[model samples]
Target chain A: MELKNLGEFNFIHSIESDTIYDPNTVVQGIGDDCAVYKVTEGYEQLVSTDTMVEGVHFSFQYMMPYDVGYRLMTANLSDIAAMGGIPRQVVLSVAAPGHIDTRILEEIYRGVKEQCQHYHVNLIGGDTVSIDGPMVWTITIIGEIPQGKAVLRSGAQPGDVVGVTNYIGYAATGLGSLSYNLDGYPMTRIGHQRPEPQIELGITLRELGVHSMNDISDGLSSELNEIAKSSRVSIIIDETLIPLHEETYKLAEALQTNPIDYALLGGEDFQLVFTAPKELSKALENLGSITLIGEVIEGEPVVQSVTKAKEIRLLEAKGYNHFHE
Target chain B: MELKNLGEFNFIHSIESDTIYDPNTVVQGIGDDCAVYKVTEGYEQLVSTDTMVEGVHFSFQYMMPYDVGYRLMTANLSDIAAMGGIPRQVVLSVAAPGHIDTRILEEIYRGVKEQCQHYHVNLIGGDTVSIDGPMVWTITIIGEIPQGKAVLRSGAQPGDVVGVTNYIGYAATGLGSLSYNLDGYPMTRIGHQRPEPQIELGITLRELGVHSMNDISDGLSSELNEIAKSSRVSIIIDETLIPLHEETYKLAEALQTNPIDYALLGGEDFQLVFTAPKELSKALENLGSITLIGEVIEGEPVVQSVTKAKEIRLLEAKGYNHFHE
Candidate 1:
């Protein structure tokens, strides 16, 4: 099962199985040097790259190979969701130490295939290499949006209400519980390990003409700061208005840390956050359990949260820093 | 300064400087969640990925950071060239240890920027991460080709002629000379380090009705075998007719090996190899320095090289194997 014994052609042919979800869009898939694809007429293109380095992004002690591949794909897919684009294809580049088992890679790739099938994206051609280091996975994704319909973060305007789907902070809370894991909260653990991209909500929100959108991966504060700076506007949110799952609250109590801190600083929650006209609040609620927690204001790009006593505090970005962390 | 000393936002901003080349095509580039762009109206899309791991693909002793980036871009661009496409955009994902100097990364990005400018490609958004392992760079390239005009490796007919562009053995010959650290073959060193993609030749060959095409990254024998297997034909090449640079021949003689061995077995040439109608030989001759070294025949997919001493030998794929190597 070791990759060293698996010859090159066999190793390549192994992963080329059952990967493509839509044959119509792919002219050539895995066997070619480049995967030739056709974009639907009248659609603009969306491209993004996501990389996960072992021990930096995820730990094997906490996540299986399947979780790694699934989370990696979700991370990139969420970017397309933020753009209100339809993810169509992804090409992966994977490097692992030669001593690793090929079966572990097969499990990782299985996770990728199943997730791509869930999102209806094609697993196109990719490059695989051997390295003398920890395993690395990088996926370059391609998505499509109707011409000129991309909802950029810079489109947030004053009087827009910021809304978020589902709950946040559960992922971070779940991560904190991993060290003393005793099968306490499975839901929060799933929140961290297997979060799904909000592709359906993205498409519907684009149709609903949301002013701007962002995916919550690097915590609520970082996402809010990005939207504010890009739109050149200020935002105000009530700290108590931020939604947290019941499990998140219970887990945070067990860990002896405030759940709000997880909501503001911890990440890997694939929920979506968006700014839309305040008048469309009812319409957004009709689509799902959206929580309108903040308001955009006319000022410099700064995000502030109001406490219960109406005290304002600056919400600075403390997202995951690649080099420093 | 080490990347650890440099903060995250500053590190990202450093590479985002002057990275865009074609502003018209890029609706949004580096500062967004995903890069948004427009494909030319009548062209289909080409997607491919290439990866380079430190100590696996290249070494710091043999190549500087600039050379690494330049050569990495060239490798992916060559895939586009092989498909007879015009490369338009690229997204890179790079991971390095925190102790690596930030200036070294700047040099790498500068090299990527310069190469993108050379090819008129937009240096779009990418993900940069930190790892506790060897440096890795993954580039996902996008290209465009006129609809139904791409030359696949499966199009060669029975009577087609196998041709190669430029010299074939110099890169492999140069790589072999790297171990001695001698000034004996600087040309070969450059060949291994800075090989350019044959985009113009590929485009012209496609327009001139080349039936099949492949870039010579995996040696002449492996590329020809790929074409034969894809096209379901047998190929016979005269090893004597294989072209080599004067320096390549001299280096081979000095190293006490046949230049044809390198042409048949060694890789990383980045040259163009194609099959065209035998009657188009005169037309192909006008395209400068194309060597017609072989012929396609109606048989099973096998590659045989005829020696000058009137002996036929099977040319197996002894190219670089990711796992076994």
Candidate 2:
């Protein structure tokens, strides 16, 4: 049945669950004006919000309702991960068209609930409104970190080594594969639909004394430029050092597309990127899948790409921006 | 110019402010992956979110950009006040069509910033996205209250006295005035456009030992019905005791409509309704502007209304549901 027929209160009751993970910390959940919970002493709180709108951020042409919810949560949680914090609570605001199916909302909530449960984050309180526009979901996450331990975008410094977790360009290729109905490359397609937040990697990087950090949400270019601008330092990344998933390389070859473009321009890669002192390079390498991709240098805060063939060119720090065509 | 021409990062930079209320607690604010702040010890945190859509929750015809932002914040803050908590920080997620004028967005932010500044609430972090749909804004608020002291909707008990602050029905009449371009009722129009969050009054009511409380954002009918259902108690409200502003009565008389219908069905009042022990009525009344409206009784959880003519009728326990229509 459509949501308009179900009614707001009925839809909420239909999807509400007894899903509190920790009763001691959560005094109340789901059914209240505001969720009241205990705050741990000596900890700093981290808060961030992310929004996804139908036909703008994602569409059913590329993702299911479950995938939409899953990816939206991942995008929001990645911000917490980027800050080297552990997510504890979340509140959601969902606005869907009244003509939308109630089951779609249920599936969306299921994805949200399962992901939050996996991370031990409480789904505390939310607002659900019926709208006449495309469906949108906004998640505000609360996380906690040890006081004075949050990695900042401005913490990168000259002589620091820049690194990333896992291969880039996978999600972009995944989007391409799905859009064009390309065969094979199941991993690349999954990457586009189910980007995973690198929470544990963030904690590890913090422990390794990483100076600065960000999640590659709007592609590597935006992340690198933001760090450079915030830290007032320049970054030079080696094109050869940038890793691409095997599926991404294969799909790029089949489509005759430069894989590097995907890594630079395609977003939705919820992977961790950080800069640390050069001396920790050996230790970082010991940790599997950590790629030393670039160096922070003393210059104007701009990003330049250098090829192994000794050619160098300035790379635009622009990425997939919603307001920029 | 439209937001598409201005671009997302440029728009963000234009609106970015260095407004930090307390540096000691706020380690980081805007321009970070997540806002970081020190958590207060021995206190419980309160969190809630609210959403407003351009055509569903409001319209530009009845409100300017400033009023939209102002009323949106008030609606969210009222939830925090309903829990007897002091609002501390807020994060916003705004999605607007790329065709929208950037100046409208600037005006909206100005209103939000001014209102937040007045309440000492920090606008720490938010997401701004371009969509192909109507403008939508979601605000997630973080508040804190003394441990175990927050009022809940389920705290009302049998024999508790129900009371409301100030008056109700002004906003509906105000909406009516704006809709028909009626003259001679400026207060009602302002009331509809600018409902204030009763934070101080909430604290006072909590100290005066209010059992259960709600903010009348969805009118008295919804508030009373929710309280009754949550507390598993019956409520009987007297028609004569339902307070109405003098302006509301005049507008209703001019329009030839029942003022009580406005109080019962028209929402956006942002007034507080609470229940207290019978002995506290004198204290509550002495506080000024508090009206005794109803009494909780032992019966099936239903809401009923009695007229001054001594006739009783079952009041439908529903109000202002977005999907119900």
Candidate 3:
């Protein structure tokens, strides 16, 4: 059904009914000018917003509406996770052209609902607008962490171990598979479509006294550079320590590109990169699939990659800049 | 300079410098993956998000980029004000076409900074994306109010007086003036371009035991209908009591339309409409520029307007629907 035929109020009502109930924190959700929530004592609040514009962030030809919504929520959830906070509430703002069918929004909301249920976050309040421009989805997530427990990007210190939560380069390889329509690599396609946020891993790292952390939304190199710049430290990573899925290397070979390039420069991996003191290496390894990739040193805020042969190469501070791209 | 030349990181740096500092609640602002704030104890949090699309919400031919930013912030602030909450922090998500000039965004941020400083709200973290579509601005405001002090739309009681904070219909007249190039309505034009949210007034009303409140963004009739429905009460307004600017009448007469229509149906006024007990009538009257225009009665949710000639007319709940428009 067309949105005009469904009417804005009724459409909002549909969303209200679809929203998951959260009686504990939510004082009031939809049907009000603002969503009200009771903040627990001794907790600090975390907020992050992300926008996805059709044709810029994703193409309808390549992404289902459900995938689009799921990816948008994942991006916001990842930001909260990067801070070692538990995401609790979200508000979304959506703008779409009138020519689109309303069922697409339902599918999108379904994806959103699935994510919210899985993450135990409430869809509190949001606004919807009809525009002549392409569809744009923006979500603001509200999360919480115990006072003084939230981590920042400026805490890394010299001799701290730089580690990542999981294998990198899979998301880029997934995009490549879809772009080339490769027959195999279903996992890579799923990786690109539904990147997971390491929420539990982030909390565990924070509890384990990790110094600084960031989510790899703009490639591993850019995230590491951010941590280094914020903490005013230099980081040196060994190329041989970096973990890559075997399929990623196979896809890189098929595309005649270096798999290392995808691991370092490709974006939207959503893996966690963090720094912790050397003593915590055993504890960090015991948690899960974390790999120690580098160490922090007192120097200019830069990232350098050491080759397997012990040759040092300075990595350019370049990644996906939305404007420059 | 074009945004392409400025680049995303530098653009974000520009915004970071423009941000107003708040040392108490803001733990971190721009540049982090997520902004962090320390919520004071015994306060409930209020969150509201609003989106403005370039062609749909404002046209560049009519609105300067600075005004666009200012107005977008105003809309979100008004939502918080409706709940009698003190807005503290905001996160913005912006998507713009790559061809746009970078200076336009600078101007937009300048206006945002101006509002933040004026309101004492901090600009926190946000995301910027390049789109192939029209510019879209979405802002999420975080606010706080003492527990149990938030004025909701469902709290109006029978015999409560319905009051408005300021004069109405000026914004509609402003749009009329801009559309027709009508002179002698500069104030109305300014009203449309830069609305002032009634944040202080809302707090005062809440202190005075005002039962319910809402911002008049969707015309007096629609706002009254919302309160009536939410509070499960009928409201009767005397048409002659509505405070409208003299110039609004002049413009309405010149355009061969009833001035009352604008007062009843115009959108984007950003004035506060509230319900308070009758015993507080004198205190309400003392508040500057307030006008009591109606009374709540125990009945079905409906809004009826009483003419000077003693004729009663049912007011339809009609307002701007983006999809229908």
Candidate 4:
């Protein structure tokens, strides 16, 4: 079951799919020298890339090669999702350490291919090189957004209702749990291994005419702060109203860190946070149970305390930055 | 300057250019997360990727970060060039060491952007991550070839003339100079550090209608051997006509290796080695000074010698395979 036993070609073969292809749209997919997608009407091309480095992004002992593939693929897919676009194809360039089994390499590709199949995206061409150190997997995904329908980080308006898709801080808690060698918290562990991307929900929100959007890869508070800075608006968050998974709270309590802080500044959640006009609130109501954390304000950045006791302004944004570490 | 010194935004900013956008076709190029190229009529899309790892593909002491960027970008561009296509855009992903200097990172991007401007490629979008070890830079380039005009490795026919652009083994020689700490050979060093992709020459050959083509990165003899195996034809290479750089011979003589062997088996030259039918030989006559090394034969894979010289069937491929070392 480990990647080391699954040969590369076999891994690729296992993930190949026979999806319905529109000849005019995609000239080639999985099997060719390159996956060719046609640039057609009503669509503007969107692309995003992510490279996951060993020891930095994930640990070899704790994470499976398949999990690494899944995580890396999801990272790119989330960018497309943030743009309210359907991912079409992915090109991968992987650099592996010498002496790593070819089977593990195959498993990594298998993981990548499986994710592409799940999202109905094609696995196109890529390059594989051997490295002198740890493995590095880089994926470039090409997507298509409907003309004039892109959801930008700078489009949030003041007075719009701030919304978040699901509980916050779980992924960070998951990462914390694994890194600290804490016992229990399987949910958090799963969250760390696979952060669910809010692709479908993002599309729905876009259709409902949401004001602006961004994925919460870094913690919710950090991402919200980004929106506020980019849109030049202030955002308030009802600390008590922010959702936290049951396991996340328990783990945070055990670690002596505020569960709210975890939810506020935790990273790699891949959840969508957006603001919508008052009129679109009704549409959102029918779509899902959206917890309104707060509303965008015309002034400076602030994340209000839900207890009404501590009205703290979360001015500093915290999340993941490659160099900041 | 090291990459750590160049802040991320500044790095991206330093590489921006106007050549990335062409009114003839592309809707967008570089900037805005991804480079978008409008698929023009009568053109087929081609894409290629290559990842170069530090300590594997390069060493910081021998080559500057800019040359790393230049070489990495050229590797993929050369693939596009080999396909006889115009490279329009590239996605670059880098996994930097956590403590890298920002200035050096900026130089890398600046080098990449310079190459993009020189080759007329747009820097679409890419991801950056911090790692625990040496830096890894990966580039994926998208190109366009005229429909039905792409020459494949398997298209060599019997009686076709084998031709190569420029001399071979210079890069290998240059690599020796750097690795062995030899005195200066700027041409050799430049040849090794920055490969001149035969983009224009490939386009010309494509227009002239060639049978088969490939970029010679995996050495002259190895690539020719691949063509023979894939095309199911034999080739007779004249040792006397094999073009070896003067520096290569000097380095080989010093190292006690055959210069002809270096030219035949060394890799990373990035020149185009191709085949054309006998009828098109006249048209290709004026295409620089190309040496007619051999002719395709009907029999099995074999490299015959001219003038009753000793024939070397085919040496094992001794090019750069990261895992082999």
Instruction: Tell me the TM-score of each prediction against the true structure.
Output: 0.98, 0.98, 0.98, 0.86
Model 1 chain B scores worst on lDDT over the 10 consecutive residues at: B175-184
RMSD of each: 1.3, 1.4, 1.4, 4.0
User: Taking the tens digit of each residue's C-alpha lDDT, what string does model 2 give over A1-325?
Assistant: 9999989888888767755766667998888889998877888999999998888888888888898888888888899999888888888889999999888888888878878878888888888998787889999999988889999999999999999999888899899998888889799888998888989889889888899999998888888999999999999999888888888888889989877888888898888888999999999999998999999999999988887686897877776778878
Task: Report every candidate's CA lDDT.
Answer: 0.88, 0.88, 0.88, 0.74
lDDT of 1 by residue, B1-325 (tens): 9997796678998888787778889988888889899999889899999999998897878778898888999999999999999999999989989999988889888778778999999988898899898999999999999998888989989999999998898888888888655567888889888888998888999999999999988888888889989999999999999988887787777888888988888888899999999999999888777999989999989999999898999988566788885
Q: On residues A232-254, what C-alpha lDDT tens digit does candidate 1 reach at each position?
A: 99999988988898887887787
Off by over 4 Å in 1: none
What's the distance in Å from true for residue B70, model 1?
A: 0.7
Q: Write the per-residue lDDT of candidate 4 for residues B61-157, one digit (tens) a residue.
A: 8788888888888888888877777887778888877567776777777778778878777776777777777788888777787776666777899
Give the DockQ (C-alpha) for candidate 3.
Answer: 0.84
Which scores better on TM-score, 1 or 4?
1
- Cα miss at B265, model 2 (Å)? 1.4
DockQ of each: 0.82, 0.86, 0.84, 0.39
Q: Which window of ten consecutive residues has the lowest lDDT sum in model 2 chain B? A: B16-25
Chain B TM-score (each prediction, in order): 0.97, 0.97, 0.97, 0.90
